[model samples]
Target: MDGLRLENEIEGEKTILMLKERRPIRHIVNIPKTRNTFCKGTKCRKHTPHKVTQYKAGKASLFAQGKRRYDRKQSGYGGQTKPVFHKKAKTTKKIVLRLECTVCKYKMQLPLKRCKHFELGGDKKTKGAALVF
Candidate 1:
């Protein structure tokens, strides 16, 4: 089949337009909406019902050793004391799941592969459903 084309007449000149070919779009990652995996807590050694949540880094403490040292170094009259990080290569961050044992109230972190988007307890996708870009 022929691709898309357009014909236009402006003033006294005839113009023809051709649309550029589009590249195939990549699909987003799909994960189960809910999971009931094994719990490795001291109270519950067997598989039990656990709450799933995304893992996020906590705020850095001002009283930390590295932060205190960096702040001390920057307080002087000298110019920039330490080198700032600017070389970031990866586009997506690794997904981490924070699993908490409902029985023993124990929490653990589970690291997964890198993904652009992450959803916890989201809607379940069916096979026949069309995907939205």
Candidate 2:
């Protein structure tokens, strides 16, 4: 014996309506501040505390081989040497976590699932209350 559950068709889709004040449901999609996982470094081969951080790409060097080649090709004439990519397919980049072992200071990257929005160490969401943005 619980709340009343009724099924009704609306807009060609069957929806279930529950009339009761029950426990709120939440969807957890955020990674916590810290995590304890296995470290594959030479110093620590066991599980250790790891500091989680978002992975970011480093600045591209100007003296790279590819850059040098491209510069050489576009030095004199010829408008636009290589083809510039314009058709981007993906809307959001995949999130990557940088896990650093506190014991040995070893760092490794872990890729996460694709999501439209991702927050690291953000505030937890509570049911029935408006999000604080």
Candidate 3:
């Protein structure tokens, strides 16, 4: 009942009641620096320790087919070739973790839930600890 809201309405001797609960959205998410998971590498197909890091996309290649086509289409005297995307619906991007197997050096990607803020190798949270100002 801490974050609950109740409403009652009466119409023609009929009573209607409604209850709603509100929860705050979490902002920050902390992840560990390393993880022990199953490695799918040919050399190491067993559970092993892996170094964890946030996955980042590399720079786009200019020689790619899409980039080459786009560049060629824009080379002419055209104001705008394609419609620019403006209707972005998502507020947060899914976080991807890059895990590398320690023994075989095999890398794999693991996607996580979307969060407003992501922290890598952050401090652990202790229960019942007083909040520091």
Best-fitting candidate, measured by TM-score?
Answer: 3
Q: What TM-score, over all chains together, does every model reach?
A: 0.72, 0.72, 0.79
Please identify which of the two predictions, 1 or 3, would achieve the higher lDDT against the true structure.
3
**Candidate 2's residue-wise lDDT over 1-133, tens digit each?**
5788989998899999998856433233588878999999999999999999999999999999999998999999778978999999966677899999999999999998666777788877678997565
Report the C-alpha lDDT of model 3 over 1-133, residue by residue, as the tens digit: 4444555556646554455655444589999999999999999999999999999889999999999999999897967898999999978888999999999999999998888999999999999999998
Give per-residue lDDT, candidate 3, residue 79. Answer: 79
Number of the top candidate by lDDT? 3
Clashing pairs in 2: none
In candidate 1, the residue pairs with backbone N, CA or C atoms under 3 Å apart (3 or more residues apart, or in different chains) clash, namely none
Clashes of 1: 0
lDDT of 3 at 91: 83
Return the TM-score for candidate 1, rounded to 2 decimals.
0.72
13-91 in candidate 1: lDDT tens per residue?
A: 9999988765433236555534577877877888877777888889999999999999999996998998989999867
Give me candidate 3's TM-score against the actual structure.
Answer: 0.79
Candidate 2 global TM-score: 0.72
Q: Count steric clashes of candidate 2.
A: 0
Task: Report how far off residue 40 is in candidate 3 (Å).
Answer: 0.9
